[model samples]
Target chain A: MKTDVSSRVVDKGQKQSHFTANLGSRYTIDRIFKYAAWGATGVSILILVWLLVTIVADGIGTLNWNFITSFPSRRAENAGIIAALVGTVWVMCLVALFTVPLGVGAGIFLEEFAEDNWFTRLVEINIGNLAGVPSIIYGLLGLAVFARIMQPITGGRSVLSGSLTLSLLILPVVIVSTREALRAIPNSLRLAGYALGATRWQVIWSHVLPAAVPGILTGVILALSRAIGETAPLIAVGAAVFISFLPEGLQSQFTAMPIQIYNWVGRPQEEFHYIAASGIIVLMAMLLVMNGVAVYLRNHFQKDF
Target chain B: MTDNVTGDIAPGSWSPKRDRAKAIQTIVKIIFGSFAAISILTTIGILATLIFETIEFFKEVPISQFLTDTRWTPLFASKQFGIFVLVSATMMISVISIMVALPLGLLSAICLSEYATPRIRRILKPMLEILAGVPTVVYGYFALLTVTPFLQIFLPDLQGFNALSAGLVLGIMITPMVASLSEDALYAVPRSLKDGAYALGATKRETVTSVVLPAALSGIVSSLILATSRAVGETMIVTLAAGANPTLGFNPFVPVMTMTAFIVQITKGDAPYGTIEYKTLYAVGMTLFIMTFALNIFSFWFVRRFREKYD
Candidate 1:
């Protein structure tokens, strides 16, 4: 009996050892590929890091106080980016003013008032499609509509036309964000409002709207950031490539940072190229600041519920 | 008792007034709902305009020539109505972009889902998204000033503007989309599969490859397709970095005009609205919109159909 048991134990040990050997070799190969995948991801991050560092180092020298205050000069050597900066600010401000009410109102209507039916579904799908539409298509639309059809209204591609074009482009984004915000609120809150003798409008205005405010603001900021950097649409709507004068009214022509950058980069002069780099830095900074603000708002108001 | 009777109006009597209020509410709802309805209508109208204008363009220029002719010199003469030359350029840039984005995006998804701890993921995910928020115009500048000069040092023949540089910049610009979507997909893979592999004495690497990745493959593939669409539709980076040379060449070293680049080129020039050049812009725009629309619809369907819901 002892001899038989010993033989059986030896057979079991052999099987186990063979299994371990095969498994160990397989694991080694697997680990190699896993690390290889990681290395690829690391390379992408490294590329982005390199880009940020290079931009800061090369563009920072031109971001001095005078660069902030001065306007473009004919010599290119004396040009600053004050006009572009002001135009970007003006465009963003107008974008915010136009998109907020329109987007939020649309969101409220869809989420609170519209019936849960095919028409609502169609609108939802449409909004998603619009969000994916190319920004340059919006540019073409602006060119045809805002710059041409409404030429009698604005007298040409002015600040107002550019802002309206961008506002339309980003409207879907804001509506999506706002709808998500509204959806996050509990159904029980609405039930309680109705129980308290509140009308539908009253419940939305007094309860739901306040709950969704932070989200609405967050969307507005992000949409404005997008509008600010948009060059193609503005270019299509005829943002003057080198507007030396500040825009005095809605009818006056204007140039944003992107147009300014494009104008300078195309020039043969190396100095203008440096100025373009400076303009890029300015545009990047604005985007970063707007994004930061949006993130902060998103985090600050994220409900535990 | 009489006072109580008067106070408690019959429910049937109360119903009429409530119905009246509901009728008013319905009208109010319709009025408010018009905004969303009209916005969608406007979007469709834009697409229709593109279609009509493009059709008009095709009428003026033969469809056979526009589709088949290899050389593109519409500005100089009507003899060249070829769309394929510029389409090839766009494809070249998009192919390069996809080559870079695919592996990086997949691996990043793997890292975020399988390798990183919660603390690391919380920090990294937002940082990756921040890349997406950086404007394409900025990426364009980065390509022109930094990337081009950096590439020039090694390749003496590289032009100041080349497809490779633009494609590289677009690759970076598109990475965030691929990564985010793939991460969401990876996260949806069942954790039980990993546990089962571990119970069978499989290593972490084996579990991720055999169990997790296969399960997430469809979502990852869809993300890649969507990223490809974004690369095609992207205008600013190509317009700035890639020069306006509509040549039928596969060489990434050369500057080439993309569809978007051609639109930018035609629109910038003084082309009248009724002219063939202007209508060609609409034609190219329609093509771009159609391609992107198909991709978008596919992605949406994928998300709706295959996206796993974890209870």
Candidate 2:
């Protein structure tokens, strides 16, 4: 009996140590994983910082008033971004003009009027897929349709065509955001508007639309920011790379900031790379401003009720 | 007598203004409906354009040659139209990108969702958003000028325009997207699941790995797939950084050309309308479209099939 009791005590002690050893390993793994996760996050932030620093360091010397004012030239030192910058402004304005009404209107129709049917479902699915469709595909569509089939109207790969293509590209984004913003407006608000004997259109126009403006604006700004940075679609639509003159109107052939940057970057000359970086700085500044506005609008106008 | 009395009262109640308002409402609805229809029209237009052009292309170049040709010198004098050359290069870069992106993205998502404090989460989220919002063209520039040179220090043989730098930059570019989407998925995993794991003496790491991640598996998978699709479709970084060498080899150290890059190459050059070279763009585009479209559909289907409904 004595021997058995001692053996059982020894076994219990061994089991405890084994359990603790297992836990020690587990705890070590937990600590390692925690640090690994932190490292991953750190690495991502580090890359962003590195990319910015590199661009600024490389481009700051080239970024001057002349760089912004002068037209693109064969000489790397002489090339300026005047033509591309103006073209970007024109395209952005037209994109905003075309997309807002169409995107917001579609969002309103889907959220307010469309019933739960196959057609609504199809539209919803189509938008989702369209959002995933590569921007280059949109470029091809623009190339084929707006630039070719509708050449008479779009003037063939003009600023109007580019803007129209971008409008289509970002329409899904705008519609989704508009729907989200509209969805956030309390049902009670709509109900109260109806209780006041307002028609559906009246309530949406006077109450819901007003409430959703900030959200829609935020979405629009972000979408425009995206549109501005876009290069491939414009390239596919055949935006000229060496235009010394600025676009006169919507129908005129144009080059935007990205195309100019792309053109500069493609050159074998190291000087062109510097100018490319400078152009990127300008583009980044524009994006930063627009994104700042979007973030501000979102935070400032976010409503609880 | 009742009908006469009702008719007399109805005119005043249903005023001309009411008729006008009703008419306006109908007109507005129709207009809005047409606006909605435009999105559909865009999709139809894309399909119609691609199909027509692609058909025209296939009429000239046999499908068998397109599939089997070992070389893709569509612009050259020899005119060999082998798509595998472009596909291989595209796949090589995308594979490299996914290699970099998946772990970084998944880990970031895990940390943000499972470990980060609210303060940290708030700061990190916007930072990631900023990363995402930075232009692809900028990334392309960074890849060509900064990353490739930096990479050349370690890899002496790495070309100035190679897949490695492009893939690396592309990976970093898409990481934020993957992280954001995966974080959403991880956040969607219910509290009860983690609690149960903890109650069973699982550590935080164990709970996340065995419980939360498993539950959020579908979403993470979908996010990864979507990011891969984005990588495949990515143009500027590859066009600028990955040189326009359409070789049928998977070498990250060397230059490569992706489908999107090829399209850019063709369009940037003067392939006037109604030419075989121009038609090749549509053919290649059709292939790219199908690839991304299939991946997207698969991702959507996966989410629908495997999403864990806690409610």
Candidate 3:
């Protein structure tokens, strides 16, 4: 007790005492934490740069027009991705065609009409859950439903099956993003439309929706990028491992860039590995262009809003 | 009073037409509402299908043997269906990935939320997220070609295919997921808390470590959990890079098969429908789904409970 009192008196007697000591200690810790944060960002940027550099160095030379134009051949010297490229484009087009209307319509209904009831909340949660479900699960579902169960068209493995599976995987993402975009539109817009003697449908069609288009397009593009790169579900739905021919219809056998890359890289040979890298370069370029457009639209329309 | 005022107005009035429009509005609302309801129904139906098939799969294969048996030889008539080996590989890869990803992810979040300028973050964060937008299959090839050779320099015993390479690449792939989610959490932290720390003569680092990070800990943890789930459920990386040897071991240098990989493997082969081999895919899938589902649910709860209580 005596020592404690003496220390307290000494502390009180000292003008700067514990305060300066605390400040010094805090300064060190603060600097360390800030640097730590900086280090993290630096490392992430480094990894991304490493990936891009390595891919470009390894794959860029092989990415010539001939590589894109030629068809796959059994001979290692002659094989290319013409068939796979065509298949990917077709699948992406079909996927976008199918998902846009259904996904956007669902988003509109939820944003404009659905009440804050238990049912609506349930639907909202369900959509969130679906978004987190892995792409592979969707593949298995596609295998069971599109390939096996409904085999009248595609006999269990075709471009159609692959497209159906990917569409399901990304549908939730589109819906959620679209709903967010719609929600960002202010209530005043709706009220003004009504005040002008416009009906609910007319108001949504004319004012609120036009305002929300940029945001909705952003979500749609992201969804497309996701679909374009997916491999697991397509593989599960029996995407041909060595498809040398182009797909003729929805039901015809096909391969995508990811599947082709997976098959080629798995080989023991070294050259096929390089071919895989070239395919990756192509895939990444496509994704970048899509994402770039999305960013541009977001910025352009955000300014308008 | 309104009638007297309007008595001088024309006979072709807007008020009656507006009433008719209101009636139409109610009908349109019902139609839109039904469309939303059906979208929900489709989602539910997918879940229903998975559950129904999974139950049938269990009936054919006894639950006890499926969980307890270690050697999975479902291809043969004997059907030695133990899922431990595959599950162990999944767990091992997931742990390694979390080790690599967590620090980088959290650090990046801290940088974006507390340190970086708005202009810098706008450019940097999206670029980082572009990594996420890259297909997993690309990462798979990068792992097999680039990462494996890199690992071979240090670990001489490392095979052409090993879990270390796959796990490392997957860790990189999942980094954006963690960073983005954690940043959102940290950004939600109110400025007053940081100001209070600064007013106490605390350094910027002290303010961030002591005040900002704690407030966002729940969000960071949930992000980690979600990233781990993604690693567990990841297929192409493990299938392509991680060698498909369903052996119950822990050596990172050795080839190990994961649950998702096994499902991919059987489906790739000519496994006939209704055969034990085909059914095993479902059984394995059910296990993987249950694990990821449970983790996701836990993560969702954690995010809600630990989220910052902002003004």
- Give the alpha-carbon lDDT of every model: 0.81, 0.91, 0.83
- True interface contacts reproduced, per candidate: 0.46, 0.82, 0.64
Best by lDDT: 2
Each candidate structure's count of clashing pairs: 0, 0, 3
Which whole-number lDDT from 0 to 100 does residue B8 have in model 1? 82
lDDT of 1 by residue, A130-170 (tens): 87888888888877777878888976678988988898999
By summed lDDT, the worst window of 10 consecutive residues in model 1 chain B runs over: B12-21
Choose 1 or 2, whichever is better by lDDT: 2
Please tell me what DockQ candidate 3 reaches: 0.52
Q: What is the lDDT of residue A274 in candidate 1?
A: 74
Ranking by TM-score: 2, 3, 1
- Model 1 misplaced regions, further than 4 Å: A1-21, B1-28, B302-311
Instruction: State the local distance difference test value for candidate 3.
Output: 0.83
TM-scores for the candidates = 0.91, 0.95, 0.92
Task: For candidate 2, write residues B29-109 as lDDT tens digits.
Answer: 889988998989999998998999999999999999999999999988889999999999988888889898898999999
Tens-digit per-residue lDDT, B1-311, candidate 1:
53455458765343224445556666766666876776787597677778888899889888898889999888885558788898888889998898888878888888888887789788878778767877777788788878998999999999988999999889888888898888888888878878998898676777887888777877887898889888988988998898888889798888899988888787766667788788888888887888888888888787677765555
| DockQ each | 0.45, 0.76, 0.52
Clashing pairs in 3: A30-B205, A30-B206, B69-B82
State the RMSD for candidate 3.
5.1
